[model samples]
Target: MAGLPSAITVYEVGPRDGLQNEAEPVPTAVKAELVRRLLAAGLPVVEATSFVHPRWVPQLADAGELLDTLAGDLGDAARDLPVLVPNERGLDRALERGCRHVAVFGSATETFAQRNLNRSWDQQFAMFAPVVERALAAGADVRAYVSMCFGDPWEGDVDPDRVVETGQRLLAMGATQLSLGDTIGVGTAGQVGDLVRRFVAAGTPVDRLALHFHDTYGQALANVLAGLLAGVTTYDASAGGLGGCPYAESATGNLATEDLLWFCRGLGIDTGVDLDAVVAASAWLADARGRPSPSAVVRALTG
Candidate 1:
């Protein structure tokens, strides 16, 4: 713990990234309540919803409605609700609904980019440039997600240099932060350290980068330790481990918020998140979804 930061920021993504892939449609109210509970659990940044076309992710079709309901409820917390915008149309919808923070997603590999966005790597940057510019012009904070940063389902072992280049471009395009994603959950602790080192060496500030990992390989916490050793503080996690890649069949949930909190707490790293509250929220969500939470911490605590 000597080298690790004493405090870190946990960006909760359960409502948006977690439930989007669920086969069952969670009601808009439930999704809104999930956001509320996550905020109540002391998560500083809770991703509220995505403005992507409903056809692609019908689960979050009520993005606008959810935002409208939480408009007055969020009060001072409204600024922490970051929504996902896949394109110009999504950005427009978000802005119309008074979204002040948004996230754009890109891929480190061309195969996943084409499959996920129907565009090549360079084309995806072109697509995000205007989105970032418009959001910045509207006085909104922008975060960029680079998927498949470690390994790709179609193209294994993505080049770290490519990931660094994408991160640099995203930062140059006005993204206030960059989230490096292990879309397929194939990353190792050593790989994470190496990736962070490469990004920092490429001129990316460590504070401007966050890590998003899936626990498919049971290495999420170990990778987090590596990131901590490398001085990366911000991380993205979902409650109850409630998500998986719809494209990569083997990819499991994002690193669970409860689990991550427990790990950080053990390491004396302050996340400012209530572990029990997050477990309770995940339990409520699990019951609503008619399944046990995939998170080990939730199961142990709730049981």
Candidate 2:
């Protein structure tokens, strides 16, 4: 707590990354309610949805409709919600719907690039170039999610240098921020600290980088502490630990917002998020999903 930043940004991914892995598509109205609830709970940046083709991610097929529903209530504020766009078509759809904050998903390993993006490691950049450029042209902010940054399911341990290179390129391409993801949640605290320092040594600002860790190995919070020690100020979390990689079979739920909030509160770091409100939201969503939340904090608080 002494060395960490006094405040940090918690980017809420529950609506998009959290719901995308559901077995069935969530109703559009429900998804809109979730976004409103998260916003009301003081999550500064709640990602609304993804524009990927329904054939690939049918769970989020109602991307457009979801945005429309939010717009009706939130008006101009809806445009500030970040959404994932996989390509030019997806970007077009998001922009047309007045989404001002967009993100592109990239992979740190070649096997994942091939499987997830259907492009080789190098090829994926070309696919992302137009999307980033066009989004910037349309007066939008672009965030690049570099997944499998720590370890990959197929490729095994990923090189930290390679992750830094990918992140630097994304920033060079006009992406304002990079969220390095430990897709399988196999990274240790030492590895997380080293990676953040490595990126900083390579001239990537710590403020422009974010840490997105999964809880599979039960190291998500520890890894976040390491990132904080290395000066990262942004983190990605989902309400109720509600996300996983649809492409990688070994991946698990993301760091729960409630868990992160409890951690930050203990350290006296201001996240501007209401822990009780988020717990309530997650509890509501758990019923909608017809299951108990995987988050420890949510369970203990609501149990």
Candidate 3:
């Protein structure tokens, strides 16, 4: 606690990242309810849904419908919910529904760019430039995501330089914040610290960066500790540890919000999220999904 920030931003990705990998369709109503519950639970930022093509991610096919539902119920607050948009088309759909906060997903490795985005590493930026330009032109706050920052299944041991270079381009393109993702959950605490420092040394502000880590190798929380020591103040987490990459088979669930909250509480850092409320919400979602949550904290609290 001596070196760590007194508070950090918990960017909840439950409704979007968490539910995007579900085998079954989560009702639009259910997704909307999850967003409301997370916001009510004091998560500062809850990503509502993705505007990616339904053909690709059928789980989030109801992106527009879900936003509309939340718009009707949450009013202006719905407009502030962040959504992931992969391209101009996705951004159009989101803008049509009044989404003022949007995120663009990118890759730090060429293999993942080609496989997941259907573009080469260089070509992916071309695809994202207009999307970021348009989003910023429309007065939307844009967050850029550079995935596979630590390791990639196809291309092993991604260099931290590649991640920093990718993030530099995104920031230069007007993205206010960049989130470096351990897409395969293979990053260790040392890797986390070095990467954040790399970005900083490259002239990127630590405050303008966030870490999105998967728990596949059970190292997500440890990496978070490294991040805190390195001066990052924003973290991306999913409720109940409910997401994995549909494109990357090796990828697993994200850092669970409950797990993160428990860790931060133990460190005496403020996340402003209610642990009891989050556990209850995740428990309710696990019941809806007809399975137990994968989060250790959720299991310990609910079991």
Q: Judged by lDDT, which candidate is best? A: 2
Worst 10 residues of 1 by lDDT: 71-80
lDDT of 1 by residue, 58-149 (tens): 88889888888888687755655899999999999988877889999899899988988989999999999999999999999999999999
How accurate locally, in lDDT, is each candidate? Answer: 0.91, 0.95, 0.94
State the lDDT of candidate 3 residue by residue for 147-174, as single tens digits. 9999999989998998999999999999
Q: Candidate 3: where are CA atoms >4 Å away?
A: none
In model 2, state the lDDT of residue 272. 96
Collision pairs in model 3: none
Q: What's the true lDDT of residue 172 in model 2?
A: 95
* Residue pairs with backbone overlap in model 2: none
Instruction: For candidate 2, write residues 132-206 as lDDT tens digits.
Output: 999999999999999999999888899999999999999999999999999999999999999999998999988
Ten-residue stretch with the least lDDT total in model 3:
27-36
Q: How badly does each model clash, as a count of residue pairs? A: 0, 0, 0
Candidate 1 lDDT (Cα, 0 to 1): 0.91
Query: How does residue 256 of candidate 3 score in lDDT?
Result: 98
